[model samples]
Target: MTNAVFHWPVSSLVQITDCHLLATPDALYQGIKPYHHLRLVLDELRAEAPLLILTGDLTEDHSADSYTLLQQLLADWPAPVFLLPGNHDERGALDQLSQQPPFRPERRLALPGWQLWLLDSKGDTPAGSFPVPRLAELECWLNEAGHQQIFWFCHHHLLPVGSFIDRFDQQDKAGLLAMLKREPRLRGLAHGHCHHAYQYDLPEFVQVGCPASSVQFLQTPDWQTQDQGPRACRWVFTPDGRLQWEFLQF
Candidate 1:
């Protein structure tokens, strides 16, 4: 072995999520017309060339045309893109679009000094679920990994976002929480499917949710009406592992 030491810093990471691709004959749509907004956001971030992680819910439905459109949209991303599963997505279609190798749903990447665990918690059925075997498998793998820090990426929210969506949460959330409690090296957790950006403080890790690149949920309305918010949200990790986030409103 050589004396070279691998250095992985925060600036190398960026995550975008919830680009629910709904196909139209001429273009794509998401209720509020967000394609142009998303393109602008990505265009700005392209210069930095950070490692991009797309959390989940890539398509509104498991349609071939939608997947193909998504592939075309992301074909020119400046940085490498990694994807996970979401409730509305089809594993087969997503894999083809991402050009991911056929192996397991989970993705384990070893960066210079950081470990990225992209978990596929979406079962065959709708919503999300984590059977005992999958939970145990993740635990075992975490035990074998070593890095300066670790970031957990998934499609479903581990905790309840709100009453409306809580019913769709992963069944084995308690099991996952137990694992998180013990894994002190877990620096952060990034996920999608909530369609909103909400950060939570767990026991030992920072849990940050990304907004949908297409449409977002209105938190509290001014006139008792819930309207769709514009697309936004991207994160920047510094070279020393510090994370900064910003939301772009188009």
Candidate 2:
């Protein structure tokens, strides 16, 4: 329910997704030390980007210690950070850190020319879909915006890109897509969870599926591993609502 206002808010933003950090640095997920990978990429992304959007799935174990560790890790980064929740994340765990700076619980975030709708898409199972209440609120927002540009960020993907992640991807993608199709002001949408880096164009907007900052999926069913470089995404927005983006993998 809070609105973030800046005297001269910059339009450029950097998105780091699916960190999946653990309680300990030595702990591993899917044969990869997620903490090690996240740290490596975070060190390199300490550039002049004005905003940082951490899409979701911040912890693999849902440990409070892991969230604390993440907070300490980004304490001094130059840009303001926005944290969105992923399916693996627990809302109570994230809410405990809500009072801290750059650790926000806001569903809607405003930028100079864009309104980032950080939706709550987590369902009862790992595969996420918004609840009826949250869905209603989202629909209202989409209907109310007059001419403001928007960039929707969430934890799951709307389209299945031939990846095995379809099992845990968005369950209500059709409803979500229908909303987007109705809105011409939507500039783009960003997400994590598949651990793959790819972009697709929707007739009037763009969709960016960010790779995990920790690891990636080789293919399907067995959940095999392939060497996926830890990655981050960047978007530079102009006052007039034009956005250009790039993905950085390391």
Candidate 3:
């Protein structure tokens, strides 16, 4: 994992998640061309961002070609890109991206006064899971983080978002939340899986759901599509441990 510390008084990060790109550029998923939509989202981000995080579900078909396509798409991006896996992503296919520059596989990132933990919640099924080993590692990191505020990034939601996707929330959420609660340094959590934007304020931290770059899922109880427009999330972190975020929809 890369452990470089930023010295800037303020740092910004752009999160583009659940791209669901297919193997071919011309392919379509859910009646929308994911590649085209991703292109549109990337174009909208013409401004420079210090860091970019792709939460998960990067490919719809779990093809190496898709990862290669993603690598090519972000080849010229001005900032570093950190990636984690979703239930749909294949580790072997995703690892190919780490071999290249600008595409990082690091799960832990350190900012000036905050630490970002990109946890892997991908499980055997669609629901998320934080295994015992991974949880132990995170606990260790929390202990080592000292007094710095922590922000978690994962692929699945820990809390229900009033949608049908709530059934697929992380199975080990209780354990994870317990660990996080014990650490007063946890400030926020960000995830992308339900394919919509929402926020929930917990006692110790706030959880923000990132919108999908390819499509946005409806908040209805069942799996339904109301909007296919692409979206992204921008996060600003201040040196004093404050986080501000907004959604960019197209």
The lDDT leader among the candidates is: 3
Reference-based TM-score, model 1 = 0.80
241 Cα displacement, candidate 2 (Å): 2.5
**RMSD each, Å:** 5.2, 2.2, 1.9
lDDT of each: 0.65, 0.77, 0.84
Deviating ranges (above 4 Å) for candidate 1: 1-10, 25-30, 100-106, 219-232, 236-244, 248-250
For 14-71, candidate 1 gives per-residue lDDT tens digits of 5677766666434545444444545655676777766677778776656787776666
TM-score of 2: 0.90
TM-score of each: 0.80, 0.90, 0.94
Estimate the lDDT of model 2.
0.77
Off by over 4 Å in 3: 1-10
Considering lDDT, which of the candidate structures 1 and 2 is the better prediction for this target? Answer: 2
Residue 57 deviation, candidate 2, in Å? 1.1
What is the Å distance of residue 124 in model 1 from its true position?
3.7
Residue lDDT tens for model 2, 30-133: 87888888888877776664567788899989898899788888777666677777988987776666557765656666667777787767777889786667
| Model 3 lDDT per residue over 1-250, tens place | 4443333333788888999999999998888889988988887786754578898899998888888889888898877788888999987766778657787767777777888888888999989988898888887787778888889999999878998999899998888888767778888799999998889888888989999988788989889865558899999877688889998888
User: Residue 180 CA error for candidate 1 (Å)?
Assistant: 0.3
